[model samples]
Target: MDIGKQIKTLRLGKALTQTGMAEILGVSKSTMSNYERNISTPDPDTLRKIASYFDVTVDYLFNDMTDSPRDIIKEGTAYHPDKALNKDEWNAISYYRRLSDEQKDFIKGQMIQLYQKSSSSNKG
Candidate 1:
């Protein structure tokens, strides 16, 4: 769904009326209505307020993913060592670059099977 639909869904989920949400965001009810109807978009400051009110990331408001904000990390221009993959993991990732198409597919299928088995076992 688009940003407008996501915003409306979040607002309704919180049981907030347009006036209530507008009050929280320091905007007019008509402005909130326009936002929900996709007639206008929220500016950066307003977007930040909305995201904070919903306890979600700015990206969550804009992006298609529903994953938790904690799981999402924004990278800066300079990479941080703590956030970078370890040497072993990087080597394994690089190895995939050398694989043939058939090999890649086989590896992907095997990984999926393994994940499914692990998940099913966890449920039991």
Candidate 2:
């Protein structure tokens, strides 16, 4: 199944209207509709929000697994032809992709600070 179909199926299963999901994801209703209809793809951040709202993993959203949904969850990680992006990582990648060159430089600076902080914490 396509990502759009999977998203639509999951949304319908959860009894959520497109508008409702759009509101939660801070996107336009039309954008949500586009995603469901496969007219446009969701940026990674939006994909993460959708996965989080539906309590599913990114792999489950992108793959066609015949096994139980619970088993998919228990498996933790699975490869999908689609980008293998978990929620937060997807959001970060999406944000980076949308940045201008100057903005990307700023982001790199910020990441350097964060990485330094993390490394220092590990040493303590």
Candidate 3:
């Protein structure tokens, strides 16, 4: 995806309207619409602001690796090229990354408990 598409995808994923994103970024709604439609690109500062607001690196917006935010995970393991992540999965991972450690732990525990409950119920 291009930068515009990336921006649009992120904004839409968060259920934000173009005008809402424009206000958050301190730009005009027309500018935001232009950016999303690829008619024009944001200036450097605006680009930085957009990246920051999305909790993503500028590289994520600028690079062609939109299908995968980063080539390597934080643990230094590289993702296999064949297994490209879709937008929703990427959005989920992005949201998870923004969570605090305690929140992450709680979510993980909940997921584990849910999985165990489901598994036990299936064994009958």
Query: Model 3: per-residue lDDT, tens digit, 22-75?
Result: 999999999999998889999999999999998878877867664554444344
Q: Residue-wise lDDT of candidate 1 within 15-119, one digit each (tens)?
A: 899999999999999999999888899999999999877767688777654332223224776544345454455445547756899999998999999999999
TM-scores for candidates 1 onward, in order? 0.52, 0.52, 0.70
Give me the candidate number with maximum TM-score: 3
In order, what lDDT does every prediction score?
A: 0.77, 0.75, 0.83
lDDT of 2 by residue, 1-124 (tens): 5788888877776689999988999999999899988899888888888888766678778865423232312234854444444556644654676679999999999999999999999999
Stretch of 10 with least lDDT, candidate 2: 66-75
The better-scoring model by TM-score among 1 and 2 is: 2
User: Model 1: residues >4 Å from true position, as ranges?
Assistant: 65-124
